[model samples]
Target: MLDQTILSILKEQDQQLFDLVLREETRQHEQIRLIPSENYASPAVKAALATSFTNKYGEGYPGRRYYQGQVNTDALELMVIERAKALFGYPHANVQALSGAPANLGVYTAFLKPFEGKIMAMRLDHGGHLTHGSPVSVTGQWFEILSYGCNENDVLDYEEIRRQALEFKPDVLVCGYTAYPRLIDFEKFGEIAREVGAISLADVSHIAGLIAGGAHPSPWPHMDVVTFTTHKTLRGPRAAIILAKDADMMDRIDKAVFPGLQGGPHFNTIAAIGVALGEAASPAFKDYSHQVVANAKKLGEELKVRGHHVVSGGTENHLLLLDVRKSHKLPGKRVAVALEEVGIVLNFNTVPNASDRQKPLFPDGIRLGTPSITTRGMKETDMVRLASLIDRTINNLKTGKISEGESAWKDDDEAVTIAAAVRELATSFPTFAW
Candidate 1:
């Protein structure tokens, strides 16, 4: 919880934003956040955000900043860059990019050219993200985008991926996702990219912590460039970074992040990222990462025990994608809303080859992760209870009592009762608020 003085200052300075803050705190306390892309930052990271560093305009990298007041900010930047390189085993790293999407865009700008080449990545419905070449995104509109997907058995088809790379002959090959639940074969992906004379770029934005904690394999030596958000499983502030394996790539990447894209960087966020990188290097962070995977696996098992279908049969990582159509004849969007009403938080996503009947499946599969819960000190037992809550919410949706427009789950007495029970369960595992 924030100090009373700060809360009072916020209320006096801006009542509207203060109200929103209170609402957010209430929401966090009442619900279990399972969104794979979301997590709570540590007190150190939060403090960095509210520091005077935010007031400084450090336009460029450390010593080369375009503005003054960067002496200490420069030190923080250099330290963060070094820590990131050490953590990920990269020869060089740029911690200035604002977020994952922007960091990826910087890579594209630095390594690729418009219309001169194509980029290959996994299909969006197959658990890849927008930056992975969704047609609507600038990455697709500017450069020719070729996509690969999981096989009929729901596993990444490396052979087919190689075939696509050969056919497309793209300049870059991307291996990453926003909702994928299986372990990635970075070495194999590297081999495929090399076979077709393409540079491999792995975006570990969703699983960086897992990689750092040794829960997932590192893609550094295999991929020429790697990019990721500092949040997610890393449990840091909202920022981004690009790591290059060679000095030649480093210069291009730095240029791309500066004149090619964003202006003055947010040194405060970078400072927070530095703190997080240090934290990730700790033994406790390693244990937390392992626990995240353990919790996700436990949650998936519990859901499957209750007759729910988990994509890939089970998860080996921090996140899981649920096929809502199995338990109830409902879409991902509906189940997500119902779950929200009942104090459970998650997202609806698309399964590979989800039918047009489930069109616009951005709201298709419910994507949830265990990073925050694990951070909250909840383990496998809590995961089982959370799964039960999700099951009950889905069952409630089956009753056809939940309309799309209903504002609050509490409006329905039975739903409210279930939500109360869920709240009570969450209260038992109260998150660290300081």
Candidate 2:
């Protein structure tokens, strides 16, 4: 029988850890969580993670395994694969890659040789992920990598990308991004990759749920390989799935994931991913996906009207990048820390064209998204309120209403008032409503 509770046994067994978790939960419930890469796993998905499947060691695919007793594990994984294929329209699914980075490594191991093969991908500070060939990541160190980025206005011009691809003639051409606010044109990427004899690999880990929910265009029938993490907008557990256009390509990827990269699969996370996939396919999740984008658009617009520097002018998807350098002498880290003290939480990030302005550690912008708040049932109007809270906080520092220094926000009375209002608004919505 499937049975569970709200960490009741953990509370009785280890009161210390349980207390810590509850405190974090309270923080989550009371803060405006705007980080783009973050979201709350659904109750059902978390429940799946807590199931008895964690004890198994399924070291291989459904039919073939080094360890026995995979009868139930095999069924669970196969069911998840079918659900993924149905959701994303991919012909092959590898749900055992642990997370996005390994899944990407699986793709590379299948095609490119170590310290060889030219790879072209987007630049990290310009919205691309580290796995897409950042200099610090193994992907960059192991391969010959060239980078592309958004233009001065934070827009990707496909013609420029095509020109670069023609010049570089990479073995793999990568697209998809982390902080990009506009729609990804996968078809254009495919066209350029084919023209240059490069394989089109999209790490759609950020927008996979949006694509599945019809909030964004699908990469299928265009991309040869796609990698996705199940958390974020999918509201799933922390795991990844890779897809191939056909089974022939999947053979290389499968061998790479099992023999080349990982050992036994985390069946607990796999089970949770299955539950999340089920939730993502529902009508309610579809509505949630669109609302997330809608909320982001509204928030970006509201902030823009208040004279904040909204990068790219506004957003077309679930995220917005705000350049504080346009309005403040301090870097974005200061504003981000101040907001955290006031109960709103997000990350400081490099804006488009950051090299011309700030370094990576102290970038000029803050990156925020609507996935977390939208999960709490926040709408466009709520975004209006959120923007006001943000603007007021920024302006408080701008106009000398509050001082800026290390933890100075904790001592300021004006900051106290802002925190009170933020807490009220954040706690007004149920922690996990939608």
Candidate 3:
């Protein structure tokens, strides 16, 4: 809970702003959050982020600072670093980079010279992120990027990937994805990278918590570098961390993150990361991770039973991608918007083989996860209900049977009565804090 003094000060300074923030928080607790990339941090984590540590200007690692008066911040920093290394089994950890993209860039800056090496990563259209060498990113401008794509079975093609690695012979082999619905074989990726003499970097940003919770395999022992955001499934503040297999790489990672990339680090977020890391190490976190996967599988099963097509057939982790167009001939974007109007939240994604010819968006898929909804204490039954609501919404939209739009409801007295009933049904499953 926020202190009364601070709340009073905020009210005096900007009551409207404070009220707006409060409403947003309330909204999150009232609606299901199915986005895999989002989560609600614990009150402890939020408090740490809103603490006085935010005023500090910590420019370097603990016990070695560029600025003064960091004794407490140094302790917080060391706690965060040690907790991360212990959790992930890394020789060294850099908790300075503010987010995942910069943490990845820090790894590249430390290991490879600018414009001198090649980067082989999963194709962005397939599931890879832009920082892995999309043309629009600085990564692509600096290094030659070789991209690999999924095979016809909608799975990673290791043989083709090895062939490409031998053909391009990149200095770095990146293994990770933002929308992949299956488990990653990190050891195989390590083997392939070793065969090509390329450094293996695993961006476990999306699955960090799952890895920590034993819901997924760890890439620490098999990969040379790993990067992740502390938020998302980790349920922490918005922050980044980099783990290296070599202790000698620590200095390089630190330098690249500081003078080579960003300015003063966010000590407050680092403190929150420390708190979150400590929390994640508990037995409860393991249970949470297990539930995350179980809930995802349950949701996938429910969606499939409702006549929807789940990408990769189903999910093995926290997320599931639904090919909405294939199931109902409705665009994912349209379905997503309709669901949002009914108090559900998720994102539209691109599924394999979905083209603009079939749907205006090349890949018409709805990507959802059980992380936040699970945190809200929702189980298989809620997922079934959610999926049924989605199917109904899609069916209604496809048949042009939605008789009441928001504008129509707001203007017409009778339509407003119908809209109120719709909202009542939507509000029956109100979300609550974890």
What local distance difference test score does each model get? 0.85, 0.89, 0.81
Give candidate 2 regions above 4 Å deviation: 1-6, 355-357, 398-411
Models sorted by TM-score, best on top: 2, 1, 3
The most accurate candidate by lDDT is 2
Clashes of 2: 0
Each candidate structure's TM-score, on Cα atoms with residue i matched to residue i, is 0.95, 0.96, 0.91
Q: Which ranges of candidate 3 are over 4 A from the true structure?
A: 1-9, 356-362, 399-434
lDDT ranking, high to low: 2, 1, 3
Clashes of each: 1, 0, 0
lDDT of 3 at 227: 92
Q: What does candidate 1's lDDT look like per residue over 1-434, in tens digits?
A: 55566789899999999999999877877778899888878877777777888888878777777787777888888899999999999889999999998999999989888776689998888888899888888888878898889987678988888888889998999998888899999999989988989889999999999999999999968988999999999989999989998898989999999978999889789889988998899998899889999999999999999888788899999998887765565788878878887788888888865556666543456788988888878989888788887877776665345567654333367787888889998777656531
Q: For model 3, what is the alpha-carbon lDDT of residue 22? A: 71
Residue-level lDDT of model 3, residues 1-434, one tens digit each, is 34456667778899898898778866776666788989878778877888999998978777788899988998888888999999988879988888988998998888889889799998776778889998889998898899898887778988899999999998999998888889999998999999999989999889999999899999968998899988888888888899988877778888899889999889899989999899889898898888999999988998888888888889988999888877877677777776676667888887776656443353578889888877667767777766766665665554223455433122244333433544554356444344
